[model samples]
Each structure stands twice: as structure tokens, then as C-alpha cells.
Target: MPATSSTTEFSRTGNGSSSASTKDIEVQLQQLREDISALAKTVAAVGNEKATEVKGKAKRAAADATDASYQMVEAAKSQAVSLERDLERQIRANPIQSVAIAAGAGFLFALLSRR
Candidate 1:
């Protein structure tokens, strides 16, 4: 009878320890979930910060490209004006030869158009 009572007590103590262990495991699992959630938020914030920086860089690059394109267009216009002035000076210096060359070009165009 004494042994039976001792065995019963041991089983009761084991049940208590088992319940306590289960609670401890549950608490640990909850803590891990919270830690993971916090880490996810941190990652998202870093990603957003990086995205903003990239957007700023892209805007700056676009502005630079636009400025370069404008500069090229202005240079082309300046070159075209310079060439027109040179052509006018040449025509004025050799009016007779210019007219003869114009007549020859016109004859060639007429022959080509007939074909």
C-alpha cells in the first residue's frame, strides 16, 4: 500500500511538470513569432529607404540626360547656321560658277526622274 501511494504521487508530480513544460514551449514559440515579426518590419523599412534613394538617383540621371540632349541640339543648330553662312559667302564669291553647277545638277535630276 505504501508503494502504491508513492507511485501515485510520482505520477501526479509528472503530470504537473508535463503541463508546465507545455506552457514553457508555448511561450517560447510566441516569443519567436514576435521576433520574426519585428525583423520583417525592419527589412521592409530598409527596403523602402533603398527604394527612395534609387528613385532620387534615377531622377538625377534623367535630368542629366535631358541637359545633355539640349546641349547637343543647341550645338547642332549653331553648326547648321555656320554652314549656311559659309555657303552664302561661297555663292557670292563665285556667282557664275555657282549658276553653272546648279544647272548641271538640275540636268542630272531631270534625267534621273525620267528613269
Candidate 2:
């Protein structure tokens, strides 16, 4: 009867050591939850930083492409102006020869159009 009573009392109160262990488990669980929250916040901050970096890289790439196209257009305009000046100089140096060549081209064009 004494052993039965002791067992019943132990089961009801869960003994001093068991109760302390239970408290320790609860504390550990709470600490685990806080640690997980901190880790999630760290991950979000890193993601935001990466997103900002990618946006900056994209903007720089777009600006570089725009600058390259502008340079190409300027080069084309320069070349066209140079070609026009060269053609004028050639015509002025040999006006009679230029006139003869022009006449021959006109004759060939007229003949082709008739065909």
C-alpha cells in the first residue's frame, strides 16, 4: 500500500527532476523559435541586397549600350561627310572626265529602261 501510494504521488507531480526537465524543454523550444525567426530575417535582408545589386548592374548595362550606339551613329555621320567631300574634290579635279562619265551612265540607263 505504501509503494502504491508513493507511485501514485510520483505520477501525479512528475517528481522534482522531471518537472525541472520539462521546464528546460519549454525554454529550449522558445529559444529555437527565436533562432528561426532571426535566421529568416537574415535571409530576407540578403535577398534584398542581391536584388538591389542586380538592378544597378542592369542600369549600367543599358547606359553602356546607349553610349555605344551613339558612338556608332557619330562614326557613320563622319564617314558620310568625308565621302561627300572626296566625291566633290574628284569632280572638281576632272570636270570634263566627270561630265563624260555622267553622260555615258545616262545613255546606259535610257537603254535599260527601254528594255
Candidate 3:
């Protein structure tokens, strides 16, 4: 073959190679875009799961606090009832003394208020 013919063949092959390389780059770019999209979706799902878990923990904490508060209120009510009963029993045992003490306290309160 002539030198010129060999040179032309080389030039044609080079052009075809460049075209194939460009097609390969385009395919790789499309695959990369797909991978990125899939990654984003995965990240979003994980984030949602974590958020749900945190929400559940918060709800459980709130319920526990409410139960504790309710128990405290019940305890306070029981204590108040016990105290009232004791006071009533003492007053009934010494009606005259209780009346005298109440009057003295009232007089002292009146004097303090006037000042």
C-alpha cells in the first residue's frame, strides 16, 4: 500500500475512536446522574426513619412525665385529706379551747393589719 493510503486509514480510525470515546463519556455521565438520584432517595428515607424514632421517644417521655405528675397530684390530695381530718378531730376534742385560740389569732391578725 501507498504511504498516503496508510495515512488516510489511520485518520479514519482515529476519528471513529474519538466518536466512541465521546459516546462512552456520555453514557458514564448518565449513569452518574442515576446513582446520585438513588443516593438522595436513600438519604431521605434514612432521615425520615430517624425523625420518626425521635418523635416516638419524645411521645414516650411526655407520657412518662404526665404519669409522674398525676401520681404527685394524687399524693398531695391524700396528704391534704389526712391533714384536714387530724385538724377536725383536734377541734372536736377541745371546742372551747379551739374557739379561744381562733379568737386570739383573729385579734392578732387585725392588729397586724392595722399597722
The digit string of per-residue lDDT tens for model 1 on 7-106 reads: 9999999999999999999999999999999999999999999999999999999999999999999999999999999999999999999999999999
Q: Give the whole-model CA lDDT for all candidates, comma-separated.
A: 0.99, 0.97, 0.99
Candidate 2 lDDT, 10-88, residue by residue in tens = 8877877798999999999999999999999999999999999999999999999999999999999999999999999
Model 2: runs farther than 4 Å from truth? Answer: 15-27, 95-115
Worst 10 residues of 1 by lDDT: 9-18
All candidates: TM-score: 0.83, 0.65, 0.76
Assess the local accuracy of residue 35 in candidate 3 as a C-alpha lDDT between 0 and 100.
100
Error of 3 at 77 (Å): 0.5
Q: If ranked by lDDT, best first, what sequence of candidates would result?
A: 1, 3, 2
lDDT of 3 by residue, 44-91 (tens): 999999999999999999999999999999999999999999999999
Cα miss at 15, model 2 (Å)?
7.7
Least lDDT summed over 10 consecutive residues: which range in candidate 3? 1-10
Each candidate: how many clashes? 0, 0, 0
